[model samples]
Target: MRTDRIFGLAVVLGALAYIASAFQLQTSFLSDPVGSRTFPIIVGSVAAVCGLVMVVSPDPEPDWPHGRTWARLGIAVLVLVGYAYALRPWGFVLPTALAAGIISYQINPRPMAAALTGIGLSVGLYLLFKYALGLGLMALPRDFPG
Candidate 1:
């Protein structure tokens, strides 16, 4: 089978599992209208749709990435994993900024631009999540001094 078909099938299966698991999440009586399962279901649905698109309309000749590109992809994955681990200890802003900066630099190879991009993204996302979405995310670590 084509690589895209295989990847799309895997994504579709994973998304189905994710949606199913989301359905199993228990919610309190006082939970909001949008329950815990809502977001996960939405995400899974989106993923499944995208996977279906890829499966149905894959590129005739996908240009697979070469050596350096593969290495960069690996680094990006590592950065994302590190970001997840650092969230509890470092809080949202710092680790997010660092990860965004690293990925931006990898994409553009411009230090100053990447730094600014990271700062902008972290602050913007923080404000959007905290204020607009009314989500309570830590700006800094609990032990972090003002």
Candidate 2:
């Protein structure tokens, strides 16, 4: 299948997932008038529309996937899973930084650039989740106050 076709199918699947999530979500008394399902429903509707558009649009040049692409994708997934498992024990910084670094390396060839990008992303995420959102993400060993 062509890349565009695959992308279109992915979009459709995402929309279906969103729609299903919206339906399956439990409502609470504290829920606003829009409800927890509203956003998902809207997102699903938009994704469905975009998928439909893609499906009907003119096909672009087909670019077949190489073996290395699959390997890279597998590595990325593995990194993500490792990060999830490592988050609690290793805390947010190290695992997140490693994951970001791996992703950066996958996208870029330069080692220094990849490392910097990863560190930058990790710090930015820390600031966003910790300070901006006030989330209690596990801190690094050095940052932990016992």
The best candidate by TM-score is 1
Candidate 1 RMSD to the correct structure: 8.6
Error of 2 at 47 (Å): 20
Per-candidate TM equals 0.58, 0.53
- Clashes in predicted model 2: 0
All candidates' lDDT scores? 0.93, 0.85
Residue 54 C-alpha lDDT in model 2? 80
How far residue 116's Cα lies from its native spot in candidate 1, in Å, is 0.3
Error of 1 at 89 (Å): 1.9
Task: Give candidate 1's whole-model lDDT.
Answer: 0.93
> What digit string (tens of lDDT, one per residue) describes model 1 on residues 1-146?
38888899899999999999999999989899898899999999999999998899876767789999999899999999999899888988999999999999889889999999999999999999999999989989999987
lDDT of 2 by residue, 12-91 (tens): 99899889979999998897888889888988999988987787683875775689988988999999998888888888
